[model samples]
Target: MERVAQTGSTNADLLARLAGGEHVGEGHWLVADRQTAGRGRLGRGWNDGQGNFMGSTVVHLTAGDPSPATLALVAGVALAKAVTAMAPGLDARLKWPNDLLVDGAKCAGILMERTGNAVVIGIGVNLVAAPELPDRPTAALAAKGAVLDRDRFAEALAIAMVDILWTWRQEGVDSIVRAWLPQGHPVGTPLRVSEQGIDGSFDGLAPDGALRLRRADGEVMLIHAGDVELRRPVEGN
Candidate 1:
């Protein structure tokens, strides 16, 4: 673990280091107290307030391991576990693809980038405060009465990620899927997926980690990529 007062983006910095032939071995982490150009999936800006958890880890794919894409599930499960452990009795759910939700609001997000045999997984969690997001609700651990510092949270997250990634390499994607499902919303929860222009109930996750969307016409669509939003239940349904 390497801690810095600030950085442009942990993922970008680590990628630059890798490009320059730096040996960022697996389980190595880079954490920043502040990020000026942090990013999320689909080119969205990730806001990182001071004292929040802004860190990245290096993962090297081994033989017989799943695709690099499946790292998203690995990250989500590790984050969910870490946060729940920090804030006991809180409902920490894994939003499909790679977001952590607390009480239906996003509290953290994961971003993964691949370079050759290495994958840099960046994670940002709102520990001290939540930024104002225009499209969706957001929350912070402090707001939920959990008093944890960035270093403490980062330490826990790093340990959880290391343990889970080992499982992914040893047991395969089925083991990860089994562990993630219980931390996520139940099957059949209504969802609105923006990428495919489909609004359907959550079917489940496919064997390869693609999202399963059960449409109204009884068609089960396997979506490889998309933005997922939990739908509000209709009154008196």
Candidate 2:
């Protein structure tokens, strides 16, 4: 584990280190107190304020393990568990692909990048503060009454991730899906998937990590990539 006062991005820093021939073995983590150029999925910039949690982990995949894509779900499950453990009585749920939600607001996000046989999983959580997002609502652990510090939360997250990664490596995607299902929105929840430009009801996650979307026409679409939003009902419907 390594903690820095500030950096452009933990993921970027680690990637650069790996490119520079730095040996970042599995379970090694890099955390930043603040990030000037942090990023989320789809090239969106992440806000890494002083009180937030910004970190990345190095994972080297071995043969016979599930695809790297499944790491998002693995990270999500671990994060939900860590946050809930830190803030007892707080209900932390996961949004598909990789986002953590409290109530209905986003409190954390996960991003994974692969280099050779190694992958860096970047996670950012709103510990003491949540940033203002343009399209979605955001919340912080403190605002939700958790009041955890960045270092403490980072520590908890790292531990949780280590355990979950072990499960994923030993078992398979089935185990990961089983662990994730309970922490995610229930099957049949209404959703609007932005990338596919489709609105559908949430079916469930496929064993291999694909999101199963049940469309209005009775077609079940397996979406591999998309931004998901809980569909709001019509006022009078």
Error at 125, model 2, angstroms:
0.2
After TM-score superposition, the amount by which residue 32's alpha carbon in candidate 1 deviates from its true location, in angstroms, is 0.4
Query: lDDT by residue for model 2 over 152-197, one digit each (tens)?
Result: 7888888999899999989989999999999998899899998767
* Each prediction's RMSD to truth: 1.6, 1.2
Q: What clash pairs does model 2 have? A: none
lDDT, candidate 1, 37-99, per-residue tens: 999989999986998999999998777788889999999999999998888878889989899
Q: Give the lowest summed-lDDT range of ten residues in model 2.
A: 228-237
Clashes of each: 0, 0
lDDT of each: 0.90, 0.90
Q: What is the lDDT of residue 114 in candidate 1?
A: 92
Q: Work out the TM-score per prediction.
A: 0.96, 0.96
